[model samples]
Target: MVRFVDVPRMRHWVEERGVETVIRGIAERIESDFRRWPEFDTQARVASHSPGGVVELMPVSDSRRYSFKFVNGHPGNPAAGLQTVTAFGVLADVASGYPVLWSEMTILTALRTAATSALIARTLARPDSQVMALIGTGSQAEFQALAFRALLGIDSVRIWDTDPRAMDTFERNMRPLGFSVHRASDGAEACDGADIVTTCTADKAYATVLTDDMVRPGMHVNAIGGDCPGKTELEAAILHRADVFVEYPEQTRIEGEIQQLPEDFPVTELWRVLRGEEPGRTSAEQITVFDSVGFAIEDYSALCYLDSDLGEGEAADVDLIAEPADPKDLFALVAAGANSTVRLG
Candidate 1:
C-alpha cells in the first residue's frame, strides 16, 4: 500500500529536523549526487501556463527509484480562494513504476525552497551576514525568512513587497519567532545596508526589481521568482558587475539571472563551490548573486528527507492507477477491472 502523509504530518517531520539540519543534509545529498552527476536521468521540466500563472512537472530518478511533482503557480489564486501554488508528488519504484508513496507537496515545496535558500546562503553568503532584504512578501516570504534566520545567523530582516496584505501576512506569521522584522516602503529602503537581498516577487516579466543604483558591494542576492523564460528580478547591469552562481547550468541559463546575459557569459554552479573546484568570493567587496530557479534535485533532496523523517501519519488508500500483476498480463488488469478477483462462493 502506498502511504500518504498530509501537511500536518509533514510539518511535524520538518520541525523535528529543523531548518539548518535539513539544509545541511540536502547539501550533503547534492554534493554526493554532483560527484557523479552523470549517473541519474535528468530532464529540464514541462510547464503549462494559464491566465493565472504556471504549472510544472519535474521528474528524475536513478536506476532504482523514480519521483515526480505536480505543482502550479497562480499569482491570482489567492483572490479566488486558492493557494497561489498547490502541489503533490509520488515516489515510485523505477523497475516497475509502482508507486511506493503518495505525499502532499505544498508544504514540502515551501520547506524545500527554504532549505535551498539556506544551503546557498551557507555556501556563498558571508559568515557574519545577519540582515536580509526580502523583496516579495507572499506565500514564500515567511519560509525564506525562517530558513535564513535559522541557518545563516540572520536575525534581522527588512521586507518590501508590492502587496501590503502580503507584507502583513508575512509579519503576522513571523512575529512569534522574535526576529527583528522591518517593513520598508520601497526596494532601496529595504536593501539599504542589508548584507543579503532576496527577490521573490511573482511577476513573470523582465522587470528590474533591483537596479545598480540600489546595489552595493559585498551583497549576496537570493534571486527567486524569476524561474521562467520571461521572468527576471535583477537589473541587467548588476550581472556585469557581480559574480553569479546557480544550481544547474543548462536549466538555469534559461531560468536564472543569466537569462538576461549572452549565451557565453560566465557563471558558477554551486556544486563546484561545494566540491572546492571553484572560488566563492575572490574579494570581500565583490557582489554575489545566487540566481535561484528552484531545481528538481533540490526536490529530490527534500523527498529523501521526508522519507527518512516523516513518521506515521494519516494515509488514504487510493487507487491512483494500477497494472496487471503478471508482467505480460496487460489484458488481465482491464478485463479484471471492477470484476471478481477472488473466488469465495
Candidate 2:
C-alpha cells in the first residue's frame, strides 16, 4: 500500500497545520536540501509546449529517495473555468523502486513555490525589508503574501493586476488575514515605495509587466511567473542592472526571465549561495533578483516534508503496486486471475 494525499486530505492537512506553518516547514526543508546541493541529481524539467501552454515533468533523486511532479501551465484555462496550473507528484524509495508517497501537488506546489521565494528573499532581500509590491494577484498571490509574512515579517502589500477582479480577489482574501492590502492602479504604482517586489503574472508571452524604471536599488525582485520559453515578466534592462540568482541555470536559460538575455549573460545558482560557496547580498544598495522557474528538487523537498509530517492513519493507503507471490513470477500472478470474468469482442 502506498500513502496518498488526495486533494481533500491535502486541504485538510493545510488547514489543520495552518498555511504559514506549512510554508515555514517546507522552507526549512528546502533550505536543508539546498545546503546539501551536491548530493542530489539535478537537471532541467522535460517540457512539452503547444500554442495553448506547456506540460512538464520535473524529476530528481537523492541517494535515498526519488521524486517527480507532473504539472501543466495553461493560461487560457481560467476563461474556460479551469485552473491555470495543476499538478500531482510522487516520492519513491530508491532501493525498492516503489513509490512511498503520492500527493496532489497543485496545493503543494503553491506552498513550496511560496516557501522557495521567501527562502531566497531571506538571504537575498535586505533584512529590514517590510513592504512587498505584488504585481500579479492570481491564485499564487495570496500564498506568496502569506509566505513572506511568515518568513520575513512582511504584512504590508501593495498590489496590482491587469484585471481589477484579480486585485479585488487579492484584497478580499488578504485583508481579513490582517495584511495591509492596498490596491494600486498599475505595476509602477504597486512597486512604489515597496522593499520587495514579486511579479507572478500568468501570460504566456513576452509582456513587460515590470519595467526597468520601476525597480530601484536595494530591491529584491521575486520573478516567479516567467517560467516558460516564451514567457517573461521583467524588462531585460532590469536583468542587466541586478545580480540574478536562479535555481538551475540550464533550465532558467530556457524558461526564466533570463531567457530574454543572451546565453553568455552571467547568473549565480541559488544553491551556491545557500551552500555558502558564493555570496548573496553584498550591500544594502545592491539589487537582487530571484529568477524562480520552479525546479524538481523543490518538489523533492516538499514531498519529503509532507512524508515526514504524516502521522499514523493521517493519509489514505492505496494499493497502487502489483505484488506477486514471487518477484520473478509475474506471469503466474496474471494466470491466477485468468479465471476472472472477461468480455471479449
Q: Rate the local accuracy (lDDT) of all candidates.
A: 0.81, 0.95
Candidate 1 stretches with Cα past 4 Å from truth are 15-36, 313-317, 320-327, 330-345
Stretches of candidate 2 off by over 4 Å are 336-345
lDDT tens readout by residue for model 1, 224-273? 88888888999989989999998887888887778998988999978778
Query: What lDDT tens digits, residue by residue, belong to model 2 across residues 234-302?
Result: 999999999999999999999999999999899999999998999999999999999999999999999
Clashes of 1: 0
After the best TM-score superposition of candidate 2, give how far the Cα of residue 226 lies from its true spot, in angstroms. 0.3
The TM-score obtained by model 1 is 0.89
Best by TM-score: 2
What lDDT, from 0 to 1, does candidate 1 have?
0.81
